[model samples]
Target: MENIEHLYEEYAQTVYKYLFSLSQNADLSEELTQETFYQAMKTIHHFRGECKISVWLCQIAKHLWYNEINKKNKTRSISIDDLEIPVHTGKNVEAAVLQNEEKLALFRMLHRLDEKTKEVMYLRLSGDLSFSEIGDILGQSETWARVTFYRGKQKMMKGRSEWNSD
Candidate 1:
């Protein structure tokens, strides 16, 4: 078994990013990240090593966020600012703004996808999870996760082309 502290060090950011993709709320993601670690610590012994530790941690975070949303009966929308899309252009304000706008547009398109596709994109792009890990988290096969991600990517590309033509 890995040390709890090491697991926190390695997986906290990944878990937080996953929650952020779902909640789009930094404060809530932070809370869920902490809660994820807490739960992991409590249930460490139950971990069966079937999946990567990062995958397991993200699964916990996903469950926590969903359960909270279910209890509150509220839906959270993804905002451009919520994505934390990096736009560092070495002090070029115009470049930064343009990059940010592009990211905003991309996320807006992403929001139009079905819930499962959106989740797959979030996990693949934001959480940096592999298809296998995503499948483990979503309770599907890796092929399904890969196909969903590819389909979502194609949709995003089409959306981008339409936006550009407009």
Candidate 2:
């Protein structure tokens, strides 16, 4: 078994970003990330090594997010706007703003996708996970993950064109 600190050092940001993708609240995501690690620490023995450690960690994060929702008893739209976009130090502010706007529009389109596709998109784009990894994380086949992500991209493209036409 890996030490808790090593697991945390490696996967903390990924877990936090996954939570942020689900909740769209940075502070809440951060809190939940801490909670995730705490829970993982407590249940580490139960982990059967059936999937990647990152996948296991994310699964924990997802369950905590749902429990949080159940406790609140409210629904909210999923948005990825809170995820930080890297701004090059040399880039002009206007260029950065425009880039961010483009990303925001893409994220907005993602919001309109069905929940599963949106989660796949987030896992693919934000988490930088491969299709196979996403499949393992979501308990699906790699082909399914690939197809879902492809369909989601097509829908986003169509939405973007519609927005452009309007």
Candidate 3:
């Protein structure tokens, strides 16, 4: 019990941030974070200490996100207006505005991707998971994951160009 408590205390914020990045909804992210910990508590006995506790918690969060996504009855894309960009330190006001605009453009492009491509990209960028790890999570080969990422990037670039042109 103490160990589980310690694990939650140490990693809850990290797990919450991860879930928030994936879900893009504060309420839903909080719910999924709670669900992740609940599932972790139920399977605590099986933890072998081979991987970091945070990694294990992330796996739970990923599973919960996948379940929630699968259960969605409507197929819809995330809206650009819905993206939340984190503030970053900048050397100048111009740089800051440029950075924010770039981030918004990227988020808008990301929203145009299919769920699987977006999932892979998010796992790669936000989770810092390697192709093999992402493939394992998504049940695909590393090559397939790489291809999906490549295609996703191409699509994002095309979308950005079109947006800029307009």
Q: How many clashes in each structure?
A: 0, 0, 0
lDDT of 2 at 128: 70
Per residue, candidate 1 scores C-alpha lDDT tens digits across 69-155 of: 997766667778879755466778788888879889888999999999998998888767778867867768999999999999999
Ranking by lDDT: 2, 1, 3
**Against the unseen true structure, what C-alpha lDDT does each candidate score?**
0.85, 0.87, 0.81
- Which one is best on lDDT? 2
- The candidate with the higher lDDT, 1 or 2, is 2
Model 3 residue 69 distance off true place after TM-score fit, in angstroms: 13
RMSD of 3: 8.0
lDDT of 3 by residue, 38-141 (tens): 89999998889776677688888989999899877366668899698756665676788888798888878888899999988997777666787667556578
2 against 3, candidate with superior lDDT? 2
Compared with the true structure, model 2 gives a TM-score of 0.61
